[model samples]
Target: MSDKGLHKTNQNGVSRRGFLGRTGSILGAMALAGQIAPSQAQAATAGAAAAGPIDNGAHVPALVIGTGYGGSVAALRLAQAGVDVHMIEMGMAWDTPGSDGKIFCNTTTPDYRAYWLRTKTKAPLSNFLGFPIDKAVPRYTGILDAEEMGGIIVYQGRGVGGGSLVNGGMAVTPKRANFGAVLPTVNADEMYDTYYPRANAGLGVSLIDPAWFESVDCYQFSRVGRKHAQRAGFPFVFVPDVYDWDYMKQEAAGTVPKSAVAGEILYGNNAGKKSLQQTYIAQAKATGKVTISPLHKVTSVSPASGGGYTVVIDQINTTGDTVGTKTVVADKVFFAAGSVGTSKLLVRLKATGALPNLNNEIGKGWGDNGNVMCGRANHMWDATGKVQASIPCGGIDNWDAGGAFAEVAPLPTGIETYASFYLSITKNPNRAEFSYNASTGGVELNWQTAWKAPSIAMAKTIFDKINSKEGTIYRTDLFGTNKIWGDHLTYHPLGGAVLDKATDNYGRLHGYTGLYVIDGALIPGNTSVNPFVTITALAERNIEKIIATDM
Candidate 1:
């Protein structure tokens, strides 16, 4: 899909001639045309023609603030709806490989491997992913600060794809009831039935390597959890992942690298998972109605007359160096920055009177998964040092497991036939208080940890249940041996700007005409498992709505 007018292609994907034939309407095409090197001949040629109205000019110019899960999906649907969507990404446009601030590898072609080589961010995108806090980039885009969380590790990716480039790509839709828990007011049947599947198709969600869980080595860990749960009398289960199994099979066949074989995930699995960059954003660009400008950070957003806005952005250079400042107007604006990022931005805007007409629910109902962590004992042997050898079997709906409960699908390292033990836990309302530090112009999260006690208690109970039921199939080795059960850290932080009728249900600012917020921040409350699929689904749901009605 070149940037030209709607070039009707015989095939499915991008068509060259049709697109390039309509490049006259493109904005600043000549500027980028020459800037692109010969290597980007196709992209450059397509960019020339990738501009024009697709239909009845029904499309309005929309500014999707971030290219993360939500904004990226929004851009795609909006473009499909014939809306002119200008995707504003605050990070680098990963045309090269490396971390946020550093480049490491170079790409040889235009495949996923080549794309990965072009981008430098790593998955398990935690604080460790960037430079140390003291030397870290001044801007606060969701980069983790290991030192700040008592040396806890949390990862976040930057660049055009956002975290999608660095995520494990394990898309698991939360249980229907889980949705029932977080967002009580939203219609679930339509969401799970209509929106969920739509998001799945868009994100390429599916179960991969189902038999892998049954591997002699994999179930070993589940046994360990069983024993621990028995001892304390708790329940646990398995959940499916959204990974593409066919890709993994090819990878395991040696046609691909081991990176696809359950390895390289925590650091940046090069194998099978699909990120937002590869799927939705790329697809959106193909529509020609969507244009993403990366390496530019948003400075502010002001409402424009007739349901539009003016966005101030700081253009950043290829080297992550600030180049200049510019402002772009949009017929509609969306705040898809993740929870911490979006809430901070909105909280500041609300407090500073920038959005003086904001609602009271701007930053309320703040809660994470009531995250709690603990280890179970398996006295059969020593622990394996593998970062993530096995994924979770699923989760438990004990009605006692916080809002939910689940355990890792145990996998034994080939070296140790004994069942591998795990330390997993979650809570119902691991709340965080969003207090505006007026002088600093930033949002401070003072966590209101009410679920702490219940989380820890549930962890212990689950461990006891596993032990009494499954028995010790293996010995245990804790990550931090110094601590006991239920003593790990949380990475699945959720809910800063919760969703409800108060916020217009779909995350539109209650009183605002065109401003919308999408991201993890809009999570109804919390999910028992990782929230990527849920997040992306909600984004898919909302973005489609925006395209159908608002845009």
Candidate 2:
């Protein structure tokens, strides 16, 4: 569909055209300035590859390690450019339905299918009023992964879609100024003019009808959040998403299968969500030059005596046990295993002499994107509605003064929690390093849980204003035993191998010619918004350059 077709009048007589007119103009100016011709933009979505089974020891021209945003974009673009590619994902495919005929487990009734390789559920919000709300479940390879480091619990999605399978689907582009600050070496003109639009279009991003947002039962929580934010004299902006807005409207009206309205995010969305498996990965598979090996984890990568790299992989089962080991040679390798995964692999490889030429900057500049979660105890009159959607649509933007963008997150327990929850992204300068532990032969992040203090301080600037304006207080029962802040975990981990320092300008690693780092690890710490859009755009920009010159 064209951009004009995306603007339709809602039932309340509000035209989405008027709501998004300014946004459209920005995109238009970008297109004009960049001179992004029709063919170039169309080329972004031109190819579809049918994935075939991976031959155990076969050699390929390109190998992408990870199926997240970076890996998917690399695989698709490389395959479209006629470089045959193979992808390795460490998680389940997630497209198969269970015996109950559901593709995913809902948040309200989390079972063994809710977690990855864990016996007990390790929810980000693990307690209510000092009591543990988590339960034991059978250990299996599930969708959400709460990976534990020394002092932090990093939440990530462990499936073919990576974080897309379990995130709230907020597709936000960073402010232009913020983007420049986050990645100084990147050409800001190219990103804003060409790559951002290309990434957004390819991801199928859409905005909710403002009229429906005002009237829908599922968005009552967001409305309350907007009301409180505005009362505090803060800006509340609607966030675009990769979800099907029309299908969400049908879900609200009971005319279709309910996923967002039925508390089905975080665990996984059964419908209406455009995860990578449904978008980039699917398109890559249709190209006939790309293949994915789910449940296959890359263990080592070493330079081959005969010009390529030898990649050691382990095919694991549902119980987290390695069933078979295989090695393959690739002429080129791309690391897209997310920030933590890629960082761990690189740090281990460097320390263990597998790739000792990798610079000391390989494991530095790791951050949590300044994540902090808090809730407000609302008054009796401030009912947040009984039917709440798990997908968030709006946020309080106080980035200028407090350096925080507070999302009105969902409390989709299928009940009236009467609390206003938020997950704020702040500008924190704190970063940690990943070091290899020789004794245990593992990589460890030197980040402490207490390092989130700066982020908490920044987030409080926004919520404190809202609390004072609404005459409310912080909720002390959501995160832990009277813990007001959920500072022990991070949902957005970014930057380990930074762009300019660890790699050349276009994600080409300094020590290696055919190796690249194209994921969130390329960004330096934070993007001041959700990291996915920036990750996608950067991958788009880098891959275009790679295809033109390096390939």
Candidate 3:
């Protein structure tokens, strides 16, 4: 890992030693087996029975590599296809309030190791592959080296749903022109005609009405953004978000009591937003098609003699402790672990020769959306007393030839009020250097901001776009600008095991078969919008081709 001093020791006090030797977790039909969602409980029970001894196959067949965005979609799709899918999540499942007193991990606080940190993410593929696995612990910083600290810290959620839980519930599919430009292989219009809406309804995105925004405290900040954007003459669209507008309205109305609304949502939202914990993964569970095995990390990928593959797992918790890993074999596998997770796993696997011939296109073209966040604020009163900054109400496009900017609206509980303007690159190809260090034998992310000359120019344009456009809350008529980069503080990351021009545009790892990266990791380029929708859509498109025809 390139981050040496960045990671603080596990604050939850779950020592790496305490986590390793703990095992003997067995669940029979009586141990809450009947409680599975209509879809996947049976698979959970089946996996439970087959999971006793690693190779014994007591339960947990059809290992799905992640429980995050793409993996969640894949698991549900496979499960609905009647494949007994075992989904692996490195972080423990959040304890949803149940009828009984049975305790689950409370993600709202650091009650268990899972809630110990403010920032979260995932990468433990499976226990089957050995040697050369990605790091499972969620580190706070990626590459802070000389980058400016900007507004609204961008973090990833680590637990069962990966970043979906921690994210602000922005359900983004970029503008038509922007989305189509990335996939040279797939027909952009055809994809829009086919996969985009399918992916949206799957994630449950709805519009934010102005009346609803009028009542919510967090949403009030967006009006400031709209005013500023209108002043700057930029097109500001009230975006569709995964966050439930009805629930937000209820929270604002005080009828729906919420700790989530009380906490302002950056660290984690337990009560309000409909993150994956409450949505697709939930539905996936209901489908009887998918089963989840939390705290198991993928070690490597090895070709089995039986014409399929084995995904080795580390079986560890968030505290860097061991919990006895497993090696499960799957006739078909999809790597949906996020960009960093999947890339490191595939790259290291290839480097150590565990799964050889991973092609020359394996670990290159890693980009972080050329992401930047900055703010422009002034102490001014709105009609409602003050403008509490909210998520993107609008953005500027013209100046950013290679990027786009959105006013990131953040409604902190009290006192400080600000909106975060996020700049996702429209055309950033600045590649970050990735190498496996033998001294530590881990992946190093030497992401230098200096490499992003075009993006830097675009970043300056976007922020200037944001600044030159509006000033409703400020005292001055003309906006003064302050620009900065918060390390690589972006939830959107692409590339690293990218689609090489040298390889097929389908993003084959060149030399590997029976191996396909189906997550955000396969997108070797950046987009001007949040990358998840595109990632999920692309995964849907890829899997449909792979399993339906390629199989």
Candidate 4:
């Protein structure tokens, strides 16, 4: 079997101890943490859930901003090392079900729970069949945040589990050969050998049952995608995902509540998918040393008068109103609020004199992960299934030849439109920077919409060839009138406070004693695939070193 095909099979589940047994004792201890099961994930809120808003002036040994992949990893490792860790999440805990008795809304039918503090939903695919699909909803602190930067709408998950709540559970690890380009300063051997397997196991990453996938009605779209890609001489590969293959099979067999098949990705999946809330965050909470405060946003982090950092937080309501303010101190701070959030905060903090000694590279390397989207109008004879799986299982590997890896995404609109949709990750060299605007007293990213041109051209290399081979054309009505590319948004926002530039090689911010960045911000730009697993693995690597030395 080839290197890329290692995760292509899950005859028995990926073992958490398989790789750790070869590594040192530190990683061996880390490997003991297991992926929370579906039933356990649903019932865990009763036990290791987030505590209510943290009290004013509380002090913690380690404070982690954001509860995403990196933050969850940091909080878990720090707590396991016997450090009292406090995680502040700017979004809701999402433990409570909504009026629909589900924690999340459906992709096709977004409600007030769809967007963060927005009166209307800001879906990625805004148009369908020459008609706009967005509709207004009551303003609430919803799951997804369509943050409008200078030239791109960064679609981020705004809840306790972070992007895990809103993304297709494609838990991918970049091929070994591409590791250097992804993080040049890091040791690839350790990552690929120790951390990647640990992350895959921790995330509960597994391959789809090939036998089941070929027979299931929900994955007929992916099968069709594979056929088209292979026909066009592209390497079609089965991608591992965090969604439970067993639960998904049950969903297909009508034995369990539907999630991926019912189009439950863009919001959140109530079943099957193993989000951070089920994996890392759940483990973090299991350590009694870790406590999370949801609906709390950190505004400032500066050196305290005596020692550590003084943190200012705002507790907000569902309507986005600031309900209370709290001041706390932390001996160490981990900035894991993702790329945009961490970069924005750090840039503003440096500019506004909160952390004046922060290095000039605070928000330097920012990129969109070369995210581009397009759909192909398949022939009526090749009818993609109406019941499409929300989680993409296959991708066309044109990254080596065309600099684009296109995931055959789903357009689960409940009817067959004969459309083959794709979300391509391209190798666009364009990088943006985030800077604080003094006039507006806000942070801004200097990313022009034109920066996506290289991405579109790279994506075209794959789709254009596939179109020619299949006698199909690009769908014009999906993004907008005559629009072939969805270049206005990015679901994978990366870089900013980049590793080896904005921070040390291991993510320690320069000029600060205990400030660290352990999130996607540490990755300069792209990771060649869905970046969560990389982020989680990097966090695991970094925190292990910190716990070994700093602690």
- Give the count of colliding residue pairs in each prediction: 70, 10, 43, 0
User: Model 1, 242-336: lDDT tens per residue?
Assistant: 34455555544556543323333322333344556557877998897787766567777777554477667776543345667776667788888
Q: Which ten residues in a row have the lowest lDDT in candidate 3?
A: 21-30
Summarize candidate 2's per-residue lDDT along 128-159 as a digit string, tens digits: 64566677766777778889998888888887
Which candidate has the top score in lDDT? 4
Model 3 TM-score, all chains together: 0.75
lDDT of 3 at 364: 76
Comparing 2 and 4 on TM-score, the stronger one:
4
lDDT of 1 at 15: 14
RMSD for each of the candidates:
10.9, 9.7, 12.6, 7.3
lDDT of 4: 0.81
lDDT for 353 (candidate 1): 71
lDDT for residue 237 in candidate 4, whole number 0-100: 86
The lDDT values for all models are 0.50, 0.79, 0.51, 0.81
Best by TM-score: 4
Better by TM-score, candidate 2 or 1: 2
By TM-score, rank the candidates, best first: 4, 2, 3, 1
Stretches of candidate 2 exceeding 4 Å from the true structure: 1-53
Task: In model 2, state the lDDT of residue 108.
Answer: 60
What lDDT does candidate 4 reach at residue 264?
A: 68
